[model samples]
Target: MTLRKRLFWLFAPLLVLALLFAYGLSQSLILSRFDRQDAQLLEGEAVRLQNLLEQNLRRNLDLVQSYAQWDTSYEFMHGQHPDYLRRNADPEALSEMNFDFMVFLDLQGRVHAEQWLPPTLTDMFVLDGQPPRSLEALRRAILEQARGLIQTSDEDLYGALIAVQGVPLNLAMGSIQDNQSTLPSAGTLIAGHFLDGERSENLQQQINGTLRLLAADHSVERWAPLPSPGVFSLNRAELSQRHLPNEEQQQILLRFSNSLGQPQMLFELTRDRRLYHEGRKAIAIFLAQATGVSLLALLLIYLGLEFAILRRVSRMHQDIAAIGPDSSQQRLQDRGTDELGRLACEVNRMLERLEQSETRDREILDAIQDGYFEIAPDGQVQAVNRALCNLLDYPAEAMLGQSYERLLSREDAERARQDFALALANNEQIRFSAPLRRGDGSLGHYETRFSLIRDSQGHFAGFRGILRDISEQVAYQNQLLDLAYRDSLTGLGNRKAFSEQLRHALDKAQREQGRLALLYLDLDRFKEVNDRYGHDVGDALLQDIAERLRRTVRQPDRVYRLGGDEFTLVLPDSNSVAAQKLAERLLAELQNAAQIGALSIDFVTPSIGIALYPDHAQNPEALIKAADSAMYEAKRERNRVDLFHPRLLSSSTQSG
Candidate 1:
């Protein structure tokens, strides 16, 4: 029936609820962080496995190139020697090479000599028409799929995953030639390995993950069905989601589409689920801590109400008439050694211990790296830690009675006040990202975690919060964003970035009822220079073009190199005249000779096409298509700029 007991009964459940809510919020945030880590990790694993596959193919192609350049092989293919197979493809040599199959083909696509590791297992390859067992089926598939290898350059190597049998085959092919004999050519040399071999086992061990290429489309049968597509229970509909959800197994699926836009293969990875498990374990530990801390806080609140507020106020006037406002270190002098005097002595000792505990708690709060503060419901600062004082570069005396607006802009402070009021009404958690005004007048980003305070009457009294400086985290995210949107070759915005920018610009134009201009540009004769001078020169030329674009466009304009010799520019709030004039000036500047390491290349020129929103098309994709069609029209004339017309799309469609 005492005042202290009444206060404790009223607020204990609310304290526990606050702790429970905090746990839930923390669990959500931690899981999301883990999910992001898993996604990043899966992406990294995909790249590694992809590179591993390429390396295998490249290694095989290197051997093929070596065999093709052999003068003896060239002579044999040309009918100058008959004992070539006996000398070169002996069992010992085949065992040392350790490849699944090797085949030699003449210039006329006729198989000359073929050797396979397991010569007895001839049923490994299967084609559409041929019987289930025929190496000839494979040869025909190669001829049909990679006939371009017939004219492959001396340095060029062709590598790809081919569905020959029931699994993806890593195949490498190259043209047969003699670098020493100056012979016109021999034919083509091909070498490859099936994924069911020892090589695949070694690959699995390297990444500590299972890798499988899943055959997806069954409606339209493949010409080369994977002979052993493995025991996958997931159907085409399930595979469309990309991954099968599993807790113990973290799976990532990357689907490979064929030329007809049908899913052909699914690149699946089942790696260690350590990160996910670690996240769950962490949440469990946090739950235990939350429960323990909540109980401890409940006890403290009850004792403080009894000792400091209710009992102290009731007994203070009678027992401590001599005590001063700053006389905290002073104690009441009890007169006798009776039971009442003994109880007074015990109470004094308890007060001293409580003082020490309060000091320790304040020290811990001040030691925290994140800023912490408490405010009245009216938004006045009531209490703060040393870290918060340093964070805002304000003295404690200066900030203790001030409004939160001192640390936040008027708009931000108002929003925060609204958020607090909403959370109080709904009895929910509060957290938000906001920019805080710092001492030097620059704004710093912070994530504020908020909790409400209540008086003895259990009414709205104040608020408490922790402000975590997230400037570094924000900068790191920005850096990642830059990497994602930027082209590595020319340092211009890439296709992904262009797509987003175009969409955003279109949205803005529609909202404002203004016009947006999109320019699609292709460099004329860029492939000629790239073929003659190589990629280094091509890269220099692209960078030069990107620089020219940066210099020509206004600061508000967005420029991007879509891919290869293709470039795009998004101009919001641009009129038709401004867009046309910009394109013309860009074309004139591009015509100027580009200097690639002292090589004066005057042949390079740009073919630019302009498309305007509300004038040409409705959406980003359609606008790009229209601009691309107009670009082709300019390319036909060479070194020219063209405007998008509805007929341009029709003409292109008809030509196709």
Candidate 2:
């Protein structure tokens, strides 16, 4: 073959392979995008279903509570006894009221009375039948569950309403009877159904509708309802028996239990292969048509460019190769003003423009101190500048086409996703600070600006933003703040910070009508340590004592080094007994000799003074003075927690 023909043949296979590869990649990308969209839709549906279930359950509970609180029902429950059911009464009075069963339970949780339909009531008249016994057991179980739930639940009135309500009776009996004997006994009674057939039917309809929505293509083979007090259950079986003898079917079985742990409903959902196959066929046809169109377009472009441009370029290259540098002024002759001629002219201009653009872009990128990156919609890194690559310790080529999430620390990925979602939803910029993972497996804190990139049509295309390494700035600010408010020697809150926090705690306690304990701790013989073994040893001993106090107290309690060896602790929501015990524990822990280099320190008991807020003082300064006065008294008593006394406060002021 000639050179052009040989080149064409070699290029043909490569062009075909490239087209095939591109088609395959496009198909995969489309499928992945579709899968993500479908997953999001499914997740939305699940959340909707969860909300629906919660609303329905809450509504049902409210309805049940309302029914249980009816006046007539309350009267019947309180008046009717078990023996009264045996008395033969007119069936018309019972017929006037609509109820499948009327059960009455006393405070001791025993079913003392019940009324049911004639035939069913007669069947359970002896209470020996298996059905009646099972019914009794179920009722008792439900009552016990309700009782336990009410105990821990925040709904205090729910249990009280039910317990106070009376059951309806046919006529006024014994203690319930008054001067209302002239009232008709037939239609005057008020009897309500707690969980009758009508309510159960309505619930069943709702459940079936939900099942249809959830399992649209599946067939329910069998469904059975379970009975209980204030409970509903269903059993469902999928119809998987094939019409043809040789065919196989798939079935899914499900059992639903209520909060009482009783099996209330069961159902089966059978997968329909017809629907599945139809969906698959639609997807396959779509993929095939998409691939065919893409390949055909790519092939036509490749062929047209190859013949009209690539062949002509080859000839121009050979001519240039034969010419010397002296003949560089010689230009290729143009035949027609077709696309290839326009391309040649544009190529010359493009080269000049490209150099200038490249230089400008490089300067701009270099000038930007913050790390800038461009990410595609699929989260792939499209472009990362030098600063970013340097910050992450990754080469530009290595980082490109990598997932943006990989650049964030693993612990911060979820938070990053939330920020990303908010930015995308609002189509606005978001500022977030999180740790970015580096190549060396260390994390550096980065403050990033995430903004949604949109096309001209206003559709979200991707993201383009900058991230700055703010670790040093943040750390320096935190250190400065710590130095201002924290004790330099003991690493506890300073006296000023402690006083502010204590005042806030006192205000909160008074507003909430809660308790607050102020503890003033003055280390015994602490001055002697500084005098005997330098201030360094004293400082180390103080730090050790501060740590011991912190460990001995509850996590919510605050310990502050209130200058020198005197410390103050503010225990919110703590009583005097707890504070005294904590004080004793602190003294015990400090009594042990602290080994600071060669200097062994002992006799480090703290004279703790306790003062109750509102009981001792109304203001922060007054509370501190009261506690301080008590501390002096404790010191006089040789290291003990002295409850503040008015006499002691007065005496301490007089002495001072």
Candidate 3:
């Protein structure tokens, strides 16, 4: 991208992010405001519910106290009570008291008699062989629960809502003492009220929240397991408002306990999330305003950049594009002293310096002894120095405009293409040895270095390279290798090559899970011949022996002369049986070997020692030593072959 476009993206996102930050802050403030308002509304509802329930509990407890102190309540209790179900009876006072149920306890705190104010005012019927819970069993349960739950005590009066048979009921318990403060308590009385009654419903309507009463039974399971029930325990914190599964509703829970302080029920209060919706609408308005301001800001940024930098840079680009390296008279025009103006002035100075640098680079490229060339983007050789032309034995006119591939051998051409592409991708230079076809169609090895060139915009322009002829260097290296590993006289590998080849053969046998035989031979009576005759006969005889052995072994085998008359043969894929047979052939080959220029030399027979891989030794040194030991035994006995064995190593050691 142009500098102008890059600057625009760089500054444009910053302005947009600034606008986004403003919007984020606004949203945070609005959410905090909504939280405070919701807190106030939920606290108001909780306060109202608490006041109403507390007021009713106090008044009901007072009424229960008045009832428990009556002399009539004492007469009604403290007796072996007959079954109330034995006769149809009406407790008229129960109706007058307007309580749900009442219980009378004896001095021992045992249930003596009870009265219930069921909605129907009668417990005269049975269904499915069962008494109605609201009449018979419910009244009995209330009175039985009043028995100190352990022992009799002079406890004070108490009232709370309790769940009986999954129904929430209000209960108040007081002592049956005299109206005056002088008398001891005679018995206890527990009065009750239905929490889900008309009066409670009217109280619920006083707050603008929906109310639900959950009895402390399986009915309370939908709530979470309590680490601590917040309000009733020590925390006593305001109940956190619950967001209902429905997105638009929220809830607050108020808990109540029974007379003994056991958890009894929950009053779940829910309200529509009016502030939540209003806050979302307010955020929408904020985002809309922010978008407009951000757009205006972005436009101003874009306009300022266009006027200040982009137009000038565009003109500079056009002017630079129109001028070529040959146009030495052309130069850029300066506008002012701003950054772009200074940048243009610097660019004009750069063009002037580049013209001078180009001349100097051209001179350096031409003056260097190494051949130099430049390839255009189209893979055509655009320019070649006189050195390259002379090195290739071709004129400049014959080489220019030709694709570089034509000058290279097929394999090296493909390799050069890959290296060229790598150089361009990595923005680095590469050097490799490649074979180039000379003008005579003969191939000469050359080391090439390739470097990529890019234009002002960093687009690929072409490739430039230097080539050095390495034919003489490569030939000298080969000669050195030959002198190091070859025996000049015998025309076979020397001791160094034999060691290397033996190790290689062992590795091949091991890899293929095959075997090979190593043969160590000594020309018997040969040193005596060297003593009598000249060294020339001895050397000539050894060369002849090497040739005979080469023809005797298989093609995969290799032969080496370890100086004098000592020779070694590597026979791969050969077992013991194969080794013995080859040794026999070698002995027979030397039997008629006296044809050294009419000298009957048959007396020079070989003492061959054969060692098999794995059966005798695994590595090259051990195998060779084993074979050499066996060869000495053969030499001691003359003109016979011996196979290497463990005992031969020991015997050779003893003789030494």
Candidate 4:
């Protein structure tokens, strides 16, 4: 081949390859953009679903609370004849509300009067023989603890409801006035209600109407009754067997509580996403068409220029041979009326475009602060900006062609892999936080956003994402949370933390049918100590006492300084015997003398009051109050331990 022909051949393949490369790059970019949009849409849908669920739950709770306050319901539960009341009122009005069953229980947790909507002739009684297996153990335990309005349910009672049970104040007060009795009165039944199919259907209709109004512009493909407890799969089985999975299928689970204060309603929502899918497909097609047209134009230009300028310019290159390094600006002059002159003009234009593109790319990369990296399908770092290298404390040359995972800490690499796998499998974006290792062997916390890179065919290729250093922000937030929940003086849990811990301990104890101990400790001469010594010395002494109490207690025990010299110790799995031992140890710890400067000061022993779970009180507040009263009694007796007595609650109320 001649030199001119050889030049044409050499440039021809380069021109074709460039066209093909540009086409592939455009295709990849389009796919990535579509995937990101899809992920955002899914996240938005999930948030909407969560909000809807919360609204439904709140509405049901409000409805239940309203029914509990009704006069007729209260009268019926208080032994007034319901038949007489029903005759006086409209039965249809009563039946309008959805209620499966409403049973009034007496103060002692005994069933008295029962009312079932769509009244079943079969009588439902509160079983005294044994607690029903259906009710959650937690609810049963609550009923055993509290004397007033107790709402609970068993497995049989699937719906949510509000139970209002308390002493009939009107009846009890009247009886007390007539009898002139100093004896404490027993509690009486008041009222309660439940939600049934009629009520559920009514609520569902309201919600469906609201949703329809909110989605006015959008078409709702299907809205039907959610499945009840006993129903088999509604189209679920058929969908699972399909060869090509449907992305438009949306499912929602709805649950509501019954009148007996049990969750019952189980519903589902399957909405069609046909419109959403169609819109996305149309967008993809439009993008693909635009890319194809651009590629065709580039290919024509490459073929036209390859034969014209590349062939003729090589033959005339001898005229330009005298060009030295100092004459770098010299251009090749191709003399021809046909294609050579046009090809030379086109080459100069192409060079100008390349220079402009490079400038724009560098500007864009420099504008971003977050580290941006793109990895090839084989896990090699194909490209990385300056920000990425600077963030990882490495040079651009060092990062290019390196495994992207090598820049991350071992834990971060594992987490990144897991997140990438999740995004690919589910076709979603995965966001997570992990420690990124620096060159100095220290870890920096980074919030990473991982998205699966896909080919034009929608096949998994690799991942591309950005990393942000969120270590400072996370640390500040954690510090705020700690300050909010912790005691400033002793570094122990504050009142808020103590209450939460107490509730958790109570829940565990109730579940296990185990006893928990709440000990109220009052320093005998704490005020005198503070007055005699400076506040600083008193504060130091209190801190010392807190440390001693913490050391003396078990790991499971939680001690709280409830302001001043008063402290509360929560002992899980502790009965009266165990509580007494703890009290003795605390008294001994404080009875000894301590030297504060020149004065040898003697500390007063703590007057301890103990309350056992399900024995003294049910709730945390009640338990604390009961323990407080017992502590007062011990203080009255001069440094002793007092077990909670019901009479103390009554006497203390009278004294107040």
Candidate 5:
């Protein structure tokens, strides 16, 4: 064979192999992108479905609370009104309100009225072999369950997913309180939503996906375990050609547990993999066409090749290599309408595009608030953007060529070096936060994301990173957390913080067999102080009292402001004697005149009440209620310390 023929045959086979490899690589890339997109879509849809279910439950609770607060419903619960069920609990009205079951119970646990959406399901109840003769019995059962729930929780309104007769229902119960006065609940209203096939269909329509109501069978092992109560969990089938017969198609499963932490439902989603198959088919076709075109092009090039053409191509390659970032005006010499000429022109165009893209990238980096930087594999700074210079309080010229340690403390610099080594060794990205030392000697908090740079041969070349100053963001978050737990006026723990402390203290006392006491204090004539003096003086006095309480209490014994002039002290490992002594000391200190600026105020005596854990009450709410009763008793006698006693509850109620 001639020389040209030998060259054509040699290059043709290599081109075909390259085309096949490209086809396989393209298929892998396309499949990866599709997998990620499908997973994200599945997770988003799962969240939407969970939100829908939660919204339905919230809507039912709001409806129940609204009706319970109405004058007619309150009166009906208080009194057995004539035709109350017929007027208000009508089936049509219940259906329109989207309530599956609603029951009103008096304080004595007598069911006044009850209604069900699907009237037939009421009689076909599967909870018992024989359905109740009257709907009143079922209503009473629901009310009893609600009462049990309320006794365990502090909220006047609470909800849970309850199973009755192998059916799931979103149930919420609320106190039927007089709108004008909420104290002394007149009755309670129980509301529910039966998760039947129709409701599932409605949810499917809203989400545009199939909704399967899996049986809450804990025995049936799931691929993806149920999430924590009220949280949604998502899982997708592992992408593999060796899938099972039923799992040939891509599938996603979403599972969420009810408030009771039992498996509520599993939603199986079948994703359309048609695009993936089509993409592979298209790549195969392109590879076949490319292979054939490569042979023809090689044959044509072999025929056209001459010593002069080879020399011109060599010259063009040299010209291309000579062009650099500073040589923007350089262009390839276009000799004629030929392949080499067109190739040379394309190279020039590519260079122009690269220059424009580099300018655009620099502009983008400068516009960002975060610092952008790159470092060589040896840990030397290669490039620094304008934002990075501003972040480190250094000029770009001074920053470039310096070690990364320039912007970090010695300890942090060592940490960064270790992290960089790890990223390079493992060929992975790393993220960390550290204190950054600026050029001005001041330190600021920064978070950095470092990605390893690799060459075409997959060897570690350098590191590129983004650094963001998060000092303000972190400070603001801390401020928000403090505000949530601390009282604004007294800087003491607020009601929510106090509740958490009390619960923890009670648990500790019970677990360790130790004593715990809760002291409830009501400043005598505090309202008078506010009325006689302005609220400013009253607030100052409260602050002073809070300081005194904190000073009097021993370490680990916290004081909390429970709104208004009410305060609570959680003292772990304390008995009646110690608690009484501390209460007396608190009263004595509070009675001492409080100095608010130039003003001095005396005659502030507190009616203190003490309740011991495991003696007065077991839980926080009961303990607080016991202490409140004793506090009321002390208030009547004026500035006395009263320990919680069973008789105090009735006596204080009678007096009030």
Candidate 6:
């Protein structure tokens, strides 16, 4: 073999290998893009499914509330009208409301009436005696929850999801009341919709996916009677034996919990495997095409180029050496009619095309609205787009060599560094929202997505990311939260917030075996002040009173305005004596003349009633009523504080 033959043999294989490597890389990139898109689609679908489940329960709550708030329902609960039950308890009525169970209970938590929809499912709700072994526990749980709802106010109804007999149900409870007639809560009306196999199948059909539910207690007997709940981790062979064909599907698990936040069930969604198989087929075809092209180019090079091209290549190098950055437009002098001459012309055209491509890429980078940045593995800023320079209030030259830490506030930089460390360890992309320091010394909120960059050998190179300003969105969310929980006039926790806090406090006290104090206050002669001082002054005085009440309470102790001249203070881990002392101090504080912008109001007094938990009442609504009754007693006496007592309700109202 001669030198030419040896060179050809070696170079030919090298060329083919390079082509194969390039094809593999391209195919990998395509497959990765598809995988990412599919994952995102699955995640979005999962969120939509969760929202649909929640909305279903909300609709049930609305239906139950509508019936519970009717005057006829109230009269029926109080045993004044039997016709109300005859009309509403019918199967047609229940089916129209999409309710599987409708139970009416008295104030004492006794079931007055109970009916099941599709009435054939009546066997599933047997709570009277010796219910089925599978449903007895669930029936008892539902009754316990219904009794608990009697303590809640009639202001609004709420819904929840519960599991019974290994089946999920949407449950809503409301207090039966006639608001217009001032008819008190006679009882509560509980309604629910059973989530059986058919309902689950309907949900899956709507989302175009396979849905499976797993018991949270690891007792799979109720659903599939599996020996254990570790089926999620079984291998393909093991799953096949169990008749679950998950080999060609991707499973996305969404864990759902009960209202108390205990793990209740796992909802698993399986998506089709078509995208993956299609990607594999396309990649194989690309590899085969790459191989054939590589061989063809090698054959042409060996047969035609070796002898004739070398002499022309040398001459062309000599001509290229004469060109410079500032050189005028020039063409090669040796214009022979061969492949070499055509190659020279193509080279010049390629250089011109390359210049245009670079310009377009630069323009695209500058046109992006969000800030884009690239950082070295050592955390130094390597490059940035035009938007980043403007966002950070720095010139490109100034920002290029600086560290990412400089562009952020101290706290944010520290947090970002920690996140970066975690990302590097996991070798994955991350997204987060945080406050960023801008160039104008003002703070802005940004949602940033950071992706890791790697070299050909899969070594970490650096990071690149995009930052989108979300200051307005964050501000609007916070504003809405404030409006929901804060009183417009007194700047205190409104009724809603106070209710939540009271519920939390009561739960904590019950769990820890502690006590809490509730104090209800009514401003004495408030109507006279509103009449004499005008509404504006009265409003200002109420604001002043709120401040005074807030100041009287210690940290973590809350004060709330329940509309009009009524206020309440919640003291966690307190006794009746502490409650009385705080109430007296609040009354003393209010006695001081409220001077709001030169308007002095003398002789402003508060009638306060003190009630202690686990002493006056064990439930929140009853505790509040006890304190309110005591406050009314104090009101009749004028300028006095009173403690809640069982006998206080009888003679106290007589005096008023």
Give the Cα lDDT of each candidate. 0.73, 0.60, 0.73, 0.58, 0.74, 0.74
> Which ten-residue region of model 5 has the weakest summed lDDT?
233-242
The lDDT of model 6 is 0.74
> Per-residue lDDT tens digits of candidate 4, residues 552-579?
8886238887777888889898889989
List candidate 2 stretches off by more than 4 Å.
1-369, 375-382, 395-431, 503-516, 531-537, 550-557, 595-601, 612-619, 645-656
Task: Give Cα distance to truth, residue 420, candidate 6, Å.
Answer: 6.0
Question: What tens-digit string does per-residue lDDT give for candidate 5 at 1-656?
Answer: 65455676777778867876786678578755765565565555666665676677677778888887777777776665768778877877788888877887777767667776644555342322444455556555556666666665556676765545444567877888777655578877887866666776787888744555544452333354323323211111111121212422455555545443555445555544554556666777877788778778876776567454666776787787878756877877756577878887788789788888999999999999889999997778888789989888888878778887877788898998899889878878899788877889898888989998888998778999999989898789879988999999998889989989989988888899988998899988888779888998899899889888888887523989999999988889899999999999888878888888887777778899899888989899999999988888889887889999988787767877
lDDT for each residue of candidate 1 in 1-656, tens digit (9 for 90 to 100):
76666787788778777877877776678777876677667766766765566566667767777888887778778787787767887666766766667788887867888776643334343222233345555456655555543453333345556565444566677667776747676777777666554655688777757775566543432222221121111112112222436776666655543323445455677766677679888887877887788788878877777775566545643555655434676675663475656767887787788778878888999999888999887778988999987887778888888888777777888888789888898877799787888777788888988887888898888788898889889989878987999998877888898888888889988998989988889999999988999988998989988998899988523898888999988988887899889999998889999988889999999999988888889998888888888899999998999998898789779988
Q: Write the per-residue lDDT of candidate 2 for residues 1-656, one digit (tens) a residue.
A: 56557656766677667666755664566544554444343333333333333344344334333434444434444564334445421244445443333444444445545455433323322211223335455445445544453333332122111110111111111111113434222111112233223433454454422232122223446533322222221111222222221222233333333333433332332333343344446667865776677567657766886787777877666654654424533444444488867765665466556666866886798678888888788878887788998887878888888987887767677787787788898888989888777888888888888788889998888888898899898889889989988998878899888988998998899899998989998988888888888898888898888787778877623888889888898988888788788878877777789989887777667798888887888889899989898888899866677889999987767887
TM-score: which candidate is best?
Answer: 3
Lowest-sum lDDT 10-residue window in model 4: 167-176
Q: Model 6: per-residue lDDT, tens digit, 99-151?
A: 87789888788889988653234433321223345444566677786565445
Candidate number that wins on TM-score, 3 or 6:
3
Residue pairs with colliding backbones in model 5 are none
Better of 1 and 5 by TM-score: 1
- Give each model's clash number: 5, 25, 1, 23, 0, 0
After superposition, candidate 4 runs with Cα above 4 Å error = 1-367, 373-430, 434-443, 508-515, 554-557, 573-582, 595-599, 638-641, 645-656
What's the TM-score of every candidate structure? Answer: 0.45, 0.40, 0.52, 0.39, 0.38, 0.40
For model 5 the local lDDT of residue 346 reads: 85
Q: Pick the winner on lDDT between candidates 1 and 6.
A: 6
For residue 448, give model 6's deviation from the true position in Å.
Answer: 2.6
Candidate 3 lDDT over residue span 1-656, tens digit each: 77877887898788778877876776678766885677568767876776666666667677888877765554445442254312312456555555766666777766666666665423322212233455556556655655633243334676555555545565677877766635776777777676545655787778788877654331332333223322222111124345564767777676654435565566778877778678878887878887877788878878887887788878888888888855885877756798878888888889889888988888987899999998997899988887899899989888889998998778888888888888888999999887788999898888988898788998999998898999999889878987998888887889999999999889999999998998898898898778877788888888888888888877523888898889888888888898888889989988776677867577788898888899899898899888988888888888788988798788668887
| TM-score head-to-head 1 vs 2, winner | 1
